[model samples]
Target chain A: MTESLQGARVVIGSIGDDIHVVGITILGHALRNAGAEVIQLGIQTPVEEFVATAVAEDADAVFVSSSNGHAAIFCDGVRGLMAAAGADDVLLYVGGNLANTAAADWSEVEARFLAMGFDRAYPSRTQPAQAISDLVADLAQRRSASNG
Target chain B: MADNVTNERLTDDAFHAQRETIFREQLGRAPYDLDEALAFSLENAKRGTVAAVLQKAKATGVAAVVPRAGVASWEGQRALMQMLDEAGAAYLPITIDSLTRELQFAEAERRLASSTTEVSALNGYPIVAHGIEANRRLIQSFDKPVIVRANAVDLRITAETGLASGGTAFVSGPMYATLEYSKNTPLSEGISKWQYIFRLMGIYSEAGVPMADDAVGFSQSGTCSVPALMHVGVILDALIMASQGVKHIMLYSMLQGNIAQDVASCLAVEQLATEYLHKLGLDDVSTYVASSDWNGAFPERRPDAYGLIAANVFAAAIARAPLNYVKTIDEGIGVPTAESNADSIRVTRYLMNLIGRQAHAWRTPEIEFELHLNLIQARAILDAIIDLGDGDPVVGSIKGIGTGILDIPFSPNIHVKGNVLPIRDASGAVRFLDHGALPIPAEALEMERERLSHRSADPSALGYQDVVDDLQFLELDTFDPATGTEVKA
Candidate 1:
C-alpha cells in the first residue's frame, strides 16, 4: 500500500535552541513523499514564529524536534501559543536525544510533555515514520470533524 | 632497490620482527587487520622514524605529505613533533594552503602563543587532496629540505612526477583505512578506486606504515563521565602494551560534546575524561577540547560551561598525563583561524615548554588507585581466559585486556555531571594575545545567515516563536518542582 499523505499541510521546524537538523530534514522528505506540504524551519526558531506561521498558513499540523535534551524547556511556550492562536486544533509533536537513563527518567519527561498538552512525545531514537503516521492520523481526524 | 637497501643498510625481516614485538608489547596484541601494505613503527623509536623523515623532508626541500590524512589534530602533528623533539629534531609547519586560502593562520599562531587550543582544518576525513601539485611546486621553490606527507596514491604521484628529479619519498599512513571506510557503494568499488589510483601513481606497497588510531567512542554515563571511563580504558591498554615492550604509542582523546549544550556539561565530561587518562599510564596523551558550547543544535537549553570546565579539566589532564600532548580548543568549531590556531599551539607549547618544563608531575595516589582498579577489572574480565589452559599477555584478546564495555550513546544534558570546573582568563588571555580569527568575515557571515534564512518558515510569525518562548521558559533556570514555574538561575 502506498503511504499517501498528499493533502496534509505540515509545518516542520526545530523549536527553541536546538541546532541539529539531520533528523528534521529526513522527516520532511518522508512526509513530502507521503503527500504533505512540508515547511521546514531549519534551526534556532522561536515558538511565536512557529505558531503564527502555522495559523497564517492554515497548516494541518506543526512538528518540532530537538536533539538537545532540553525538550521540557523547548516545548513550553509552544503549546500555549498554539492554543492562543486558535491553532490548538493543529497536531503538535516533539522528539530527539533529550534524556538518557543516566540523568532523567524518560517516563517523567513524557508526563511533563503530556501535561504541557502536547499530542505526542517521541522518545529518543524513535522511528521517523511512526511520528509522521500519528501526525497524519490526527490531522485526518481534524479534517473530517471540521467538514462534518 | 629493495635488495640494495636491504643488503647494505637495513634488513626488512629483522626490523619487522623487532617492530612487531614492540607493537605487541605496547598494544597488548598484534595489530588488528594487520596488512603487509603498512609496516608498523616500533614504540620508543617512532620519534627516530619521525626525525629521519623530517630530516629527509628538509633535504628534499620539496617534500609534501599528500592528503595529509589520518592524524587530523594539531596534537596529532605535535605528537609527531614531540617524537621528533625527543630526538632533538625540528620541521617547519609551512603549508601552501595557508598562503593561498583566506583562512586565518596568523591568528592561529597568536592563539597558540597563549594557552588556548586551536582547531585544525583536518577535522573530519583528513585533509582532502585539494592542491597537491601546486603545493609541490611551492615546496620546490624553497631552498630548504621539505617533507611532503602523502598516502600511497599521493606518494605515487609525487614519485612519478619527480621521478629522476631526485627527492626522498617516505610514505605516510592513511591509505589502508581510506580504502576501508569510504562512503561509496560496493566494497569492491571502493577497493577498485584505491587500486586504480595506486596503479596510476605506480607506487604499490605490500606493507604499509602503521599509525595510532585514537578515538573516544560515545557513551551515556551522564556528563563527561562516559569519556572519563573510556580514557581509563585507553591508558590501561597503552600501559599493558608498554609493559610488553612497545616503545611508542600515540594517544588522542577529545571531549565529545557534540550532543551537549552549555560549556559546563562539555567541561564536566572533559574533566572526568582527562582525570581518567592521567590516572592511567599515558602521561603524554595530547588533549584537544572539541567545544561547540551548545548542546546539539537546541537552544531552549542554556550553553553548558564546556569551555570553562574544559580549560580546567585539560589543565588537569596536562598535569596528569605528562606523556600525553594537548591541542587547543576550537576543535569542533570551524577551521581555527590563524590567531585561534596559534593560541592553541602556544597554549599547549607553554604548558609543555615552560611551566611543564620541570619533571612531569602525576597525581600519585590517584594513579595508584586507578591502576589497582584497572588490574582488578582486567582480572575479573579475563578470569575465563585465566581459567582456560595456558595464558599469556601476548595472547590476551582485546576484549580480555580491558573492561571491554563499548560506551553507549545517549541524549541528555551533559552538564548534569558533578565535576567542578575552574575558571580562568582563558578567552581573555587569548584575546589579550590577539589570537582569534575575526568572527567570520561580516559579509560571509551575513551570507550564511541569509542562506539559513531562506529555510525560515516565519520571520516575525508569533505562533512558532511562542512555542519556542515557552520552551525557553522551561529552561530559564530550573523547573521548580513545587510551583512548576521556571526558576531563575
Candidate 2:
C-alpha cells in the first residue's frame, strides 16, 4: 500500500467500438509498473467478455475505458452482468470520453456511471497518477477493515 | 509459425500467381480489369499525380497541403475533393471505409446501400463496395492527384481496387498497418500482405504508370513519438517497399509541437530514407518529404483552433516539406464541414505564400542537435532490427518488435513489446522515460533521463502523473509557468 498497488489483479478494456486507447494504455502500463497484475482485453470488447475475463482472472478490480463517446450505452449491463456472474464485490473503475458530445458539466456524467454501480468513475482525461493513488488508498482501507 | 513465404520480398512469379487469385476472387462483383486500370493510371499521371505534385512543391519551395476527408456516397466525396482542390489542395485523399479496410466487403455494401443520411454510415469511402467504376468516377471527378488512404493488416483488395480505380498514390506500409489497425494479425502476415500490394503497384508502374508510396507503419505515436522512432519506421517501410520495385516514395513526419524537433524530423526522414535506400543499392527510387500536422487534440474554441492549425502550417511551411498533411479546425468537435476543411486550406495557402519567397533552410543549433539525435536513435533501432533479420528489414522488423528491441510506445499490437515510454522534458522535447530493452547505447539513454530530470517541479524524480499530464498537454487551455505544465489539470 505504501510503495505501490500491492500486486492488485486488475482487468482493463475498451468497451464497444471505442478505439481510442491512449488513456487506458498508459493506465495499464502504470498499473503494471506499480506492481499490479493486468489483463488487457483491448478495444471493441463486449461487457459480457469483460465480466467473463474478470471472473476467469479472479481480478480484484476491473477498469472499463471507452472513447468514442458511447460509454453510456456500451456500459448499460456491465454491473448487472458482474452481479449475475457473482463478482459483485469486485471493484469497478470507468473513465474516458463518456458521452457522445462534450458535456456541459462532467459531474452529471460521472453520477450517471456511479448510479450504474461503478465504485469510481473518472471524467475525461483524468491522470493515471490520480487514479492509481486513489486505488492504492481505497484498497488499503478496504483490506484493513476486512482483516479487523 | 513460420511460412515458406515469410517476410522476404515476393518473387516475380510468386506475385503474379497470387494476383490471379486476388483480382479474380477478392472483388465482390467488379470485374478486376488490369489492362484498363493500368491505362487509366497512365493517363492520370500526365498532369495530376502525387509524385508529380510533390516534385512541383519541391521546385516551388512550398509544401503541398493535403487534408483528410471522405464520405460513403460518391456525391459527397466528389464535393469534398473538388472543394479542397479549389481551395488549393495539391492532391486529394479517398479514405476507405472501416469494413472495406478489414475486407468485410458484404457488410460495407449493406451500410452503403442503407445509408440514408448525407454523411456515411461507414466512416470512409468503400473502395470494394463501390467497386472499380464508382471509385474511378469519384477520382476522375476532381483534377487534383488522388491518394488512397487505408490502414490494416490485409490491404490486397483495397490496394488493388484503389490503384485500378486510377488513384495515383497509395498510403500505409506493412509495419504501420499491423501496429495501428490490426489486433491479432502477426507482423509476418503484415509484411506479406504489403509485398503483394507493392508487387501490384510495381506491375502498374512497369506498365507505364508511375506510383507513389510511403512507409507509414505507425501514426503520430501520439504525444511522445520521440522523433527517432518515427524516422526509423519511415526508413524501414521505404526499404521494404522499394525492394518490391516501387520507384517514387514519400516520407511522412508527424509535426509534434516543438518546431526545432519538428523541422529536424522533417529533415531526418529524407536524410535517413535516402541514406538507407542508397546504402541498400535502391538508388533509383526518388524520395520526397511530407510532414503531417499535430495529430493530437485540437482546441474547442474556434479562434484557438484556427491559431493552432495556423501554427502547425507555419512549421510545415518553414521546413518546406514537399507534402503537408493538414488538420481541420472542426477537429475538436465532430465531422468537418466542407467549408471548415476549405478554411483550413486557405489558412495553409496564405502561410505558404508568405514564406514561399525565402528558400533558405533554417539551421539553428537546437535543430542541429535534434537532427543528430534523430540519426543516432533511428540508426540504433534500424541496425538492431536489420541485425535481428540477418540483414533483411522484412524479417528484422518481425523479430525486433517481438524481442522488444524495436519497441514502440502506446502500440496495441500483440507482437510489439510496447515497453518504451516517451514523455516531454522541461523544454517540451520528447525524451524516453523508459527505453525498455532498446539496444541504444547506455550513454544516450542516460542523456534522455538526465534531460527529463531537469523538470522544474521535481528535478530529481518523475511519475505516471507527469506522463498523464504530458498526454493531456495539448488539451490543456493554459500552462502553469511554475510547474512547467497546465494549472487546470
TM-score of each model's B chain?
Answer: 0.34, 0.93
TM-score of each: 0.33, 0.84
- State candidate 1's DockQ: 0.03
lDDT of the candidates, in the order given: 0.36, 0.76
Estimate the overall C-alpha local distance difference test score of candidate 2: 0.76
The reply for model 2, stretches above 4 Å from the true place, is A1-11, A15-19, A27-39, A44-48, A51-148, B1-8, B20-31, B356-362, B446-450, B456-460, B480-489
Candidate 1 chain B lowest-lDDT run of ten? B426-435
| Predicted complexes: DockQ each | 0.03, 0.18
Residue range B1-489, candidate 2, lDDT tens digits: 234334456787777677776656765344466788787778877756888888887887777888877777787778768888889888898887656776768877887886543645656788888878888777877777799987777789888889988887898787677776566678777778788888788888888777898667454554557888877778878998898878888888887677778778888888888888987788999888877877776666678777777666666666777777878776665456678889888887888767654525555788887888878888888888888878788777877777888778777677788887777877677777777888777667766666666774443466556766677665555553764655431
In model 1, which regions exceed 4 Å deviation? A1-148, B1-248, B253-335, B353-364, B378-489
Report the lDDT tens digits of candidate 1 across residue range B299-374: 1211322243244334333333222222223322222233333343444334433432342453344333333332
lDDT of model 2, residue A146: 94
